[model samples]
Target chain A: MSTPVQAPEAGQATAPRRLGRGTLRFLLPPKVIAGFAVVGPMEGKGPMAGYMDTTLEDTYYGERCWERTESKMLKEAVQQAIARAGLSEQDVDVALTTDLLNQCVGSSFAMRSVQVPHVGIFCACAGFASGLALAASLVDGGFARAAVVGASSHHDAAERQYRFPTELGIQRPPTAQWTVTGAGAVVVTGGDAAGPMQITHATLGQVRDMGLKDPYDMGSAMVPAAAETLVRHLQETGRRVEDYDWVLTGDLGRVGSRILIDWLKERHGIDIDGRHSDCGAMMYDASEQDVHAGGSGLGASACVVSGYLFKAMGRGLVNRVLLIGTGSLHSPTTHFQGESIPVVAHAVCLERPGTR
Target chain B: MSTPVQAPEAGQATAPRRLGRGTLRFLLPPKVIAGFAVVGPMEGKGPMAGYMDTTLEDTYYGERCWERTESKMLKEAVQQAIARAGLSEQDVDVALTTDLLNQCVGSSFAMRSVQVPHVGIFCACAGFASGLALAASLVDGGFARAAVVGASSHHDAAERQYRFPTELGIQRPPTAQWTVTGAGAVVVTGGDAAGPMQITHATLGQVRDMGLKDPYDMGSAMVPAAAETLVRHLQETGRRVEDYDWVLTGDLGRVGSRILIDWLKERHGIDIDGRHSDCGAMMYDASEQDVHAGGSGLGASACVVSGYLFKAMGRGLVNRVLLIGTGSLHSPTTHFQGESIPVVAHAVCLERPGTR
Candidate 1:
């Protein structure tokens, strides 16, 4: 593959951290010092039960509204992450966060108490990975010493805002994935910090839309973006599928996950059969949880990586992991307006230090 | 004031770029190579008419829906800015954009055609400042050689989403500000690039809430945040108000602007009388436009800076400018839920290189 190059502007030097067009190879890898996840009662009953830091008895999580519940979960996750890292609120530099709610109020309200400088980012479900990549870059570049990156989604909040209200008892199609009622936060510190996981590389995705207007089947609409970013990351970094111990994708459920495998093989001749697994698919037991396809939302991948994967890494169960967070960028208004869903995916590589 | 310092991690050197808790002192300042603005007919008829790159005869701008119009305007702004920079789409590294829309669809849709890696940020109207700071840091840190940062807002679109439908034509209170139908894009390159304006410093703001719940009186809700960021920025950078030729704020309109001036003088003992101006207040003539307070939106400060302010700078009318983009972070849902408004403001310092 040819290297993506631009005409050098003025005194520009080849940045040591930038590997390709959109891929960043950090010279001083940022360490993920701590991770925390909070989920609802339903998610606590799922396969990811033991990995979660806190599980609420209900979706409301003691709050009056689902939105406030989301904000609380996000706040708890971030506070827990910082605490687990042996740092206080004043020790962190910034909080980069986002959620599925309108205007991303979940993050804004949550950060009101976290009290650090807040940078609200939006990539739909892919927000966690986007935040992670940006936070890692900031730490590696010395713009921040430590950053708390998080994302959250409440099932009831997503249902009412993006689809039918929970009280309406609307029937979702088989292709529809359940929005995970959870929040996850990761504390990323600079290279000097010792941690189990290090962020070594990142690849930002481009917006990809193929005119798919079926909002119920977000999986189908998002496959192209997921495959695009995954392929680009591998190609740009000159790495093969086998190089990674786990190729983890965000909330691309059953259909999207299968399609991604086929698309990557057909389009780029990449084989990722055993190494690839999806956070959405892993979130719930197909038969027991009534979630049709699986779990989805900004919180799905976030919870999986921050809760399950990081814990696994600490136990030496995994070393090299590539997390690709996928998002379908569509709102109810856009769907009503007959606009197709635009999708994006961002990839971040996490490795145990000295794994190579 | 005590210097903001954290316990340095293992093998960590004191980063030369961090000035205070949230302020960044860019070692190699990013240059603003080009800027482009597109405004609706009403805005074109206002005082900023001559500086705008494009003016639409109607709000639709030839599009069928208001949302599409916003997306179109954002796309045009980014394209025009890139063109003005004498670069192709391939020359730019990424597009950092956001708008006052549900899930930030305005930016996602616009970037679908821009074909660059997209980073969507949300801080309500303060998004332009957030994007600029992130883009500047990315460029200065060598992760990106050049980046395009932009923000957009449409009057009807924002009105319908955030408040009463425009078709209802509900009477707005005197404290309400007009949402500007406009979009602006700025091209920022690495320090090696030669340009008229240079971004030397940035301060990311924390979420500030004074328990103000009035959706109509957003100016009042946001004043605390504006004051907080401005004070923090000045204190962190060790610069006085007089150091800047102009201290420009985003969308604080008439009432909030007055509150800010009085509040700063009373609380912080800093006088910014003659050097201060609000983008929203400057956009329209008080007598002719009939906008009760003034303009307010993500596009308000964006259009003013990319259109009028940059042009003024190029012509040597101003040398040092401090841009504080402000946002009231409460959504219609949050307002409906009886939650108080959370506000944020990010400040960016721009100056002519030789003058500094």
Candidate 2:
């Protein structure tokens, strides 16, 4: 299903060039050799079902509990990604992973048996995007020959931790997005590899708080950060909306997606109306899925990119792609303390090997 | 008290060469220009009190809650570290931060006002070591000329989340370590910078589970991981224990340190008795402080390195040091689920630029 990228000889060195204002231009771009996604039954019935590598018969995935299930799904995604890339555990040097679970136990436990050097990262749902930037940096800098990045989230596991328990069957407001029960992994290698997808540029994001405190309304809280990063990436990279075939966001959902378009147009004088599509908004059939706002969780972006987007890219459906992963950086503790939510977004530019 | 490191011209590119196994040898190493530690009043009376930049009279640090106080301390540490380096926040390209808090609110909320690009990392207490490696990779690879890495933890905040509430005055087992109420930050720059401390190499650690499930006995659970990383680092770098002035382990505390010494001797046929110390074990005067096993939090390593160790390094007390940050990756939920503790350790080799 995927062609493996060639790795540089052991002890090789690569360089990364810092570009205008917070942007990094990898001199030897990192190649995305393979991606795999494992999702729950509901997600398998969604729009991108065909692209899913594995759809569990039950949420437990045969595990004893939801947390264990989430961990198992992440591990499966990673192993499948490596296998799909024609690589093995030994070929992978590092694994950068995270999930919405407290202390990032989902990724930690998942990577426990993978035997790859692991680094846990957390930026709420934006973890996958941050993981990509770091993994690409490692590969591009020759710190690692191949790096695997993954993120996972189980709806039940996340609900009990962030909100009320699923057993309570508490009502969710219209502003609340449904946490996706899925996991995704991607294999990134050095520029020497022969892969269709290449990460050429990245932009690091700053935390931006707009004084929004409603935990249910995370989309609104995260919109400013998304806009900030997208604008920064475009300006720093000297690119325009027309320069890319698509501008994909992580999981801003319906309300946040609308806010993003209007915010970009009003604040940055840039319009992405036609170019923009959100992973969250596209995850499910809005009318049929019964997801209030849209699909969320780190898994939302993870599953969408690893399953739908990468497959589309392989088929030449989209070439130059700018993916911005946005996150709401607030804990229930902070929300209870009446503090405003802080948010962040990271942008990575992936392109077809020979494309503009 | 410190000198600012010189940064290369914008767009400069540097290379990082891969070493044996899991180590990365930086062609141009990153220099630690400055470090700052902030602690609560209880920590102020500890052995390293003199080294602390600020010791708050109260745990809240004038904040309304323990969580906010932790965030404030992290931000203050970052600001003070940059200032001590004779740089401003604008000069820092990135901030890699994490804490014991769920979702890493301590670092994220702290970075909210700093305006620097933020990357949240979590490896329990090993986050600072991971952050240092990533920060060094960015600087060495020229992705960022200047990056600041910080970790923070508040004892009260952590107790309520990881265990029982402080108000309960729960009796801790003798093997359990006291969480540190502190924060630390360090500014890292490209090798062009003339600084006293240089990070020459780094070794990423893999997760290791030894099937030890007792949350109170984290030291025993983490020992195997510490030994694993330490051995890998030595074998990869071709360095013996005698090569380093000190082999520091992050927050192994008393029990874990003892276990590490024995584990290394038995498993790896290496001994680190005379050259070893633990940040957790050394954080307080055990007899006087009544801190059970010892100080154990992300802040334990952060405070020690930024305060005691760095000061000692500056004074030529230690030249070449290999600091291994250790973490036991287990949450209350994992414990409740009957899972063994998974642990990880990351090592960074720091040296006085001219030293052997």
Candidate 3:
């Protein structure tokens, strides 16, 4: 969509300016040339009983007992993906990686260890999908031969940044999801391949401000934006909500997922039915895992790109997937703007070979 | 370059591997597609003095203060460059931007304000040139039609993060130069244009650990890397130091500049003669300005891309220009290792239409 233009000056202070309609055109389309997933042994560890099941707790030795460092996980994931693609570092024209951290430390530090030139990206949870979209655009524009998109999360590290120490008796929110400590990587190139999935299109949602105050409660904060972007993607691509084998939203826990579904149906007349799934929910067995919700930015990103999604592709259980990432655009300034929190989102459509 | 591999027994420990020469062949040559430079208001009216001079005191805010936030500066610079290239935001398939901040907050935050999907890059002072190199590779590989590259810095914000406030009487070495608080942006695309300059090739230098420990003193810390990259570019590209009408290093204050010249002559067997210059030196009056060295990452980036280099192009003072950016790759881990500092550099060659 083209950016709206400001209305012509009427020279009247009392009249409001009319908003111009934005233009929509495809400059680049999304496509997946390769994919990779990596998991660390430490990520599977469970938290202490009775502690907030949704948050990772720091243990002795300055490390989180329940989660691994996202940077380490991401490096492994990206390396494996690169190796699997039978492409050397030099074959990668660009790299887009992101994670939940103060400044995408995971992506930045990971790039340092790789030989390929890279750039770090961040859009909160939506960052991974956005990275994929951007990478696909580069490939479509003929700017990159192969690009890698990766994301990771470390539960222990993220908890400390969002909440108090484990010792602090903070009330747990039902909507809160435990961050899965994992990483996922994907390699995208031009031309046809044996891979089952290909990206068809992508759409980025405008930043929307909806008053969500708590930084830790991201599910509630990002749901609205997620819905907005998903609808926009379907609209822009002329696709229907039921066209995909599965519709996935990154990191939206049970509560946020419900909210998103309801909003989509009510506002956009799009009912996703049971085909809609949440990556966070699928990352772990909630009943056995004790996670109230499922996961966070890194968790959702890693799980969706690596876990069931890719596995399904391999087994041919799913032919097409629509992946949407939601992000909270909260900053010190936006926080100071009162209780409202702003959010951004992006969506990418992937189709299996031989699928219409 | 291809990564070196050594066969070893299953039980044998492997030694550190070096990059193989064959790997270098994969990198496509870089070309300059579009460039822009802007000089912020500089009038000795703010908190400090020595306005417009590269040699201002480390704490001088007046002469070098950027009128807008670092984020705004990057966005505007990038927007203008893309517009000047007669391309819309969608034309940029990949966007790369960098800064000197620890977290790359400037680039990250600035990207949030733009409609273009982008990734944040970090290479310290060498970021500007490195960005160009990456952009060119993307274009050459046919992954993107055009890419946007930008770098920005803010003295007030950076100072607080690096050391004690100016109020603290911290001793500084003579080799230190003040960082310029500004930004510069360029748009690089494929296809021929009426512009006089074209990017020829770009080369990146290895990150060298020079064992320099002082972060406050960047000039001395970055000279070796700059010299190494410059020499390597000349050797690899089969271009003599005198081939270009001008050879500009982003920012190597007075002291570092002298050291660089001496080092180049001693190690590379090439003397640039009077053709060599530094953007830091050109930003302001050297002696009168309090900046012992001219500027660091931001200063050099802003001054060259915006102030002097672009002006030179406009005035037709020089048809061909070779710009080199030198960066210190220092981290907390290196500090613990008792390593002084490591530096990495990148070089970009630009030529007028008829020169090459």
Task: Find the 10 residues in a row with the least total lDDT in model 2 chain A.
Answer: A1-10
Per-prediction DockQ scores? 0.71, 0.69, 0.10
Q: lDDT per residue, candidate 1, A1-356, as tens digits?
A: 11112222232233377767778877778999999999999999989999999999878878899999999999999999999999998888888999999999989999989878999999998889989999988888778889999999999999999998899999889999999999999999987778888898999999999999998899888989888888888888888878898889888898888888888889888888888888988889888989998889988988998899889878877888999999999889989998999999999998877676
Candidate 2 residues lying further than 4 Å off, grouped into runs, are: A1-16, B1-16
lDDT of 2 by residue, B279-349 (tens): 88787888899998888899988998887777877887677889899998999989988999999999999
The TM-scores, one per candidate, come to 0.96, 0.96, 0.73
Tens digit of lDDT per residue, candidate 3, span A1-356? Answer: 11112232244233211111111222323345456655433334432111111222322223333222465567777877787778888777667777765545566556656765455555677778777766665565444567788887766666655455556657677767777666788887763445545665666555555657776577777887788677666765567876787788887878788888888889878887687887777666666776677767665665466544665566666777888887765544334334345566677776654465
Clashing residue pairs in all predictions, respectively, total 0, 1, 32
**Which pairs clash inside model 2?**
B6-B193
Better of 2 and 3 by DockQ: 2
- Which candidate ranks first by DockQ, i.e. highest? 1
TM-score of chain B of 1: 0.95
Instruction: For all candidates in order, state the fraction of native interface contacts they contain.
Output: 0.72, 0.75, 0.08
Clashes of 1: 0
